[model samples]
Target chain A: MNIYIGAENIISPLGSTAEENFGALSKNSSGIKKTEAAGFDKKSIFFSRFAENTNDFSFDALLKNCLKNVRSKISPDIFSSEKTLLILSTTKGDIKSENVNPIGKSVSELQNSFELKHAPIVVSNACASGVIAINTAANFIRAGVYETIIVAGCDVISDFVTYGFECLFAISDKPCAPFDKNRTGITLGEGCAAVVLSSHKTIFNVEPMRFIEGTSGNDANHISGPSRTGEGLYRTVKKTLELAGITEKDIDFISAHGTATVFNDDMESVAFDRLNMQHIPLNSLKGYYGHTLGAAGIIETAICLQSMRNNTLIKSMGFEEEGTVKKINIISENKKLSLETVLKTSSGFGGVNASLLLKKS
Target chain B: MNHLSSYCHISTKEIVTDKGALLFDNTEGLEVNDFLKTVYKKLAIDYPKFYKMDSLSKAAFLGVELLKKENAALAEYADDEIALLFANSNASEDTDKKFVNSYAEEHAPSPSLFVYTLPSILMGELAIRNKWYGESLFVILQKFDAAFFADYCNMILLRNAKACICGWIEITEGKTEAFIFLAEKNGNENNTPLTKQTIEKIYKTIMKQSRPSKV
Candidate 1:
């Protein structure tokens, strides 16, 4: 049984739709900018936030808007169908809310607004939430628990999160330069992205890509720090390839989770090198998206779908010179290529690493 | 069909096993952290990292520790054979509030508290302790749903993992109710079949007997 994935939607600083974001990416546009006095110490910090006002409830707005856009792209009957289940991937949903249960209200709001057949399951595994949510959706479809699953990943920029990162000194001072020699750290961003996975491809108005296989692994090393050996990332990619019945050589491109923190990009380089995928052209979308946290894996996967559709290799936005101990073929220029199969990987806090494969179908 | 090999429940007042055997009762009226320390001492766990973890991680660690104590064969599995699938209602809300207070009231964001803001950190703690590099995921549900756990655990066990350590660790508003269970391919005659009804029954039975502990 093959899971078909399509109807990709993105609500980010770059644009509201996947096509628009892809267009901006093709032009090497970055959403990151220096915000005045956004840091805990009142220091100017770089952030990739929505240009339009989100009216204080950015989390809710992003979800509602992204879902509405996703609803438009798929068959109308799918939303009302009992076989469809909704999964929300978020690190923090409305953290600014006074209520202790920050995500419950948003889940209810989304279900009520969309008239979803079932209550959405929320995945909140730090930064890996998005990819794991999509993987969970595919797992459900394969298990015959649901025919169609809509996975939405969203996180908003707030003082709560920003200050937390700032305290940890994980926020980059400049627009994040992932995998670059001068890379500092992550530039936090806000965005929401959703994709529809189904057992049948006919539900999508556009041609859907084959949801090959997705898997996650833990580093078992640190809660906050990535492993020096990239054990989890390496294992997940290997597991994904094995489950997909493919080889490292078959992966044409890699969408790596390069958070631009000196350690993360280095860790990914080691992982890819260990997987013998060092030669495969890879790009970290963080240079453009600025590590959008929970929304990253979905948005980047959505971009990969668009790349497969357009047959274009989007450049690693801020990468210039090689940085890591293990060399990786980072795409420095946007080029057209025959991308048959692409691997998307993400590593997050809590020692979580996830990888998924998507083949052009 | 998968098997619910071993399970442990940690509530505010006491700890219980799958057979309704009381492991430890909190007669000291200790706080959340103190209660976890008491359990850790009772189990004779030497991992000093337990002292550094937040309430959610402590609860989950204790729950898993108790489960492993009951199922000695679990330690024989390969490092990457066991997966961690945990869910909760509030999602690190207990720590989130403390972290928020650090910046809002204390005038400085506490990095230590901030790191524990995600509930998945507990899984990381488990992975580090057990050196299990298998799959790990943390989901937020409005309430505990046994069907979701059974179906998801079955899917994960079929495709990615050989055994799964699943839990519903909810620590919010000074209340801790962590129910951690292990699901494996084979079951002994005494083990229960992994099903929604059995899981719900076990959870309810544990919750009904728990007396809320004072912080």
Candidate 2:
């Protein structure tokens, strides 16, 4: 069973659609800027936030907005079909409003408003939530449980999360510079994005790409810290490639989980080095879209699809010098390339890492 | 040939297995912490990390440890061949509230509490204890859906894993319900297909046997 993935949509600070987001990326325009007294300590911090004037600021609103946009690109009947499933990925869903049960009401609203035949599966596996949600969708399709799945990832910024990171000293004071020497920490952002995966490629309005396969691995090291050996990320990529019957040589680019935290970037660099994939073109969009937590994976993967469609590679914005102990090629400028196969990977707080491969169909 | 091998359940006051035997119980109306500690001590698994775990992780750790005790073969499998699938209705709400109170009431946020805010961190704790590198996923459904677990475990078994430990560990307010079952690609002593009905039957039996009146 071949999984076809496309119909990518996003509602981020940069733009409202994947094409629009890619347009901003092509011109090297970033969404990150300093917010006044945003930190827990009343320190101004860099964040990618929507204008106060926008209507899609809340968690539920952004999810609805992105889902409606995605619905426009696919067949209308899929949403109500029993064979189609919706998988929501988020670290914290509406936590600021309903801390007692953050995700339940939002998920219920999505099901009722969208008229989905079945309840959606809500994934809250920290940052890897988005990546794992996509993988879970593919598994469902492959097992014939569902013919189609809409993998939606959404998260909104809140004082609760901000203070948590602030207490841990993880929030960057300036714009995050992924894989850069001076990189401090992540600048949290908020957004909603989704992609469609189906056994029937015709459901997609645009030509869908082949979703080869994906897998996850655990570092088994620490809950809040990344593994120095990148054990989980490396093993996941290895398993994914082996399952897809490919190698590092077949990959044209990598959309890495460069959180800009010293440990995370270096850990990824170490993993890429260990995999002997140092020569592949790689970039982290966190610089443009800040670290959107659960939405980061889906948003970045959508941009990867755009990169494939346009035959262009987006730069690792905010990256100037080689920083990691291991040497991996980080794109510093936008360039054109015939991208045939690409890989996207994400590692999060729970000692979890995930990877997936996309090939031109 | 995928089948349910072993299962363990922990209600607010009782700890029982699928073998028609109660391993332990708290008839004294002890607090959640004290009850879990009594079970941990009975097992005599002296891993100090238990003290640091949130109530959710502590309960799950106890569940898995008892599972290993019942099915010794669980440890025989290769590390990467065993996967962990856990979920809950409330996520880490108990810890979330605590973390919030740390900043809102205590005037300072604690990093330790913030680290355990995500429910999947409990899965991480399990992975570290066992050193398993297999695929792990934690999902949130509105309630305990045995059908979903069966579907997910079947999907996971399609991968390289030979066995999977699926759990629904929910800890909220003063309520606690932890149930974990092992699904093997092949049956060991007995054969019970890993279907929705089988999982539901087993969990229901445990629920009925543990608290009796509460469930």
Residues B95-169 of candidate 2: C-alpha lDDT, one tens digit per residue: 999988888889788999999989999999999988988899999999999999999899889775899999999
**Of the candidates shown, which would achieve the greatest lDDT relative to the real structure?**
2
lDDT of 2 by residue, A32-133 (tens): 988898877788988898887656578899999899989989999999998999999999887862364668988999999999999999988889988999
Fnat, 2 decimals, each candidate? 0.88, 0.85
For model 2 the local lDDT of residue A145 reads 96
Q: After superposition, how far is residue B114 of candidate 2 from its true place, in Å?
A: 0.6
DockQ values of all predictions: 0.83, 0.81
Candidate 2 segments whose C-alpha is farther than 4 A from its true place:
A53-55, B213-215
- Please give fnat for model 1: 0.88
Once superposed on the true structure, which residue ranges of model 1 sit more than 4 Å away at CA? A52-57, A97-100, B211-215
lDDT of 1 by residue, A169-278 (tens): 88887888999999989999888899999999899999999999999999999999999999999999988988888899898999888899999999999988999999
Interface RMSD values, listed in order for every candidate: 1.1, 1.1
